[model samples]
Target: MQDKSKEAAILRSWHKNVEPWTRAVRESEIRSRVAVSDAAIVNAIIAQSPKHVLDLGCGEGWLVRALADLGVTAEGVDAVAGLIDRAQQRGGTFSVMSYEEFAAGAWQQAVDCVVCNFSLLGHQLVEDVLAAIATLINEKGRCVIQTLHPAYSGEPYCDGWREGSWQGFSEDFSDPAPWYFRTLATWLAMFKGCGLQLEELIEPLNAESGSPASIIFVLSGSSRK
Candidate 1:
């Protein structure tokens, strides 16, 4: 029941704060380092030419739309109803459902790839979510996850160069979401525990000032023994 309340709060927050800024932010970032990282992720999977792909926590379906434009059959899921409505209105097949509610067998025996862009970190039960993603992937399938750098996660930073104290905000400000700010080592271990092998790690140039920015992980699932 506590988890349910948390999830509900997250969904409400998304509707109130995050969904309103989704399109503009995504469009602007798409032309910046964020887009470069996204392209790198797509490139890694292009070699396999996956037939079915799932975009978890897909907001406004930007990445899903991009994948579809590239001719990949993609479906998206998000917990926020407003985001899902917008995504579907844009001709995308998206559902307002949490990863917890997703059925592995409903999609297929397995999915070729699962792309989680700036999502899934906030859940209190992150391990369960990761495990669910592992089950959703086909053997040797790919999983791409992108998240903000640790320095920005719950770190005190001055927003303005003028004289002012650095105010603190939650790391997962995007959705009023709850996040466990794991270090790089912790993230790697989480994936490994879910039976995924790290294939590539790309750090994007900071969109704010071109310094080293966010981290993206491209992982491949291991065959069941």
Candidate 2:
């Protein structure tokens, strides 16, 4: 287990830096080619028709807004108060809380779906987060994570910890938290150890570049051994 205090600190600093950068790119970020693949993730969640949903590290509440637009009860939580405040101002349901804090609480009402989008990176506590995700969902519930594809990310076939920064965007972005890169196999193993089963792994590719911009993992607890 990671030291909760230390994990919380890292989360806070990273998100504090990210809040403004994300705000600058809102809505426009979704139109990027890489973001087009996110549509697949959204489609998968909608197909599940979840009654209630939890979005971990939910930045700016775009996913929540989309889900609510479909009549699904959705709530978002982020460590950055700036992002949470903005989300509320935009008429989205949001809370200012880190994943560690959010996961430590008792969610008596387990949700049908939990989404962790691109925020579960560079942390040794990812396994712990996965365990927490298990407790957040009900039986037959699913957890979906959309993140950088291990194969095509950074160096080909590299599996190790590396500090990451905002890139492929404008010079305006800065100070990203570090990332612990893992191969697809490593990710699957972590899921299994956390008492979850990897149901599917989808890589969203860039049409022009012929490279995957991100990967989405669909996981389930019932399938765990």
> Each candidate's TM vs. the true structure?
0.76, 0.86
Q: Tell me the tens digit of each residue's lDDT in model 2 across 76-172.
A: 8877777777778879778877655655764445899998888786455678778888877778789988888887776657576665665655665
Give each model's whole-structure lDDT: 0.67, 0.74
Q: RMSD in angstroms, all models?
A: 6.1, 2.8
Off by over 4 Å in 2: 1-13, 27-35, 223-225
Give lDDT tens digits, candidate 1, residues 1-225.
Answer: 655666555566677655444655555634443546567556655655788888888888877888889999888888777788888878878887765665333444478888877676543456667777777777768788877665544454422111111123333334444444666677788888877778878776755677545677877875543
CA lDDT, candidate 2, residue 24:
54
Give one clash count per candidate, in the order shown: 0, 2
RMSD of 2: 2.8
Q: In candidate 2, what residue range of length 10 has the lowest lDDT sum?
A: 27-36
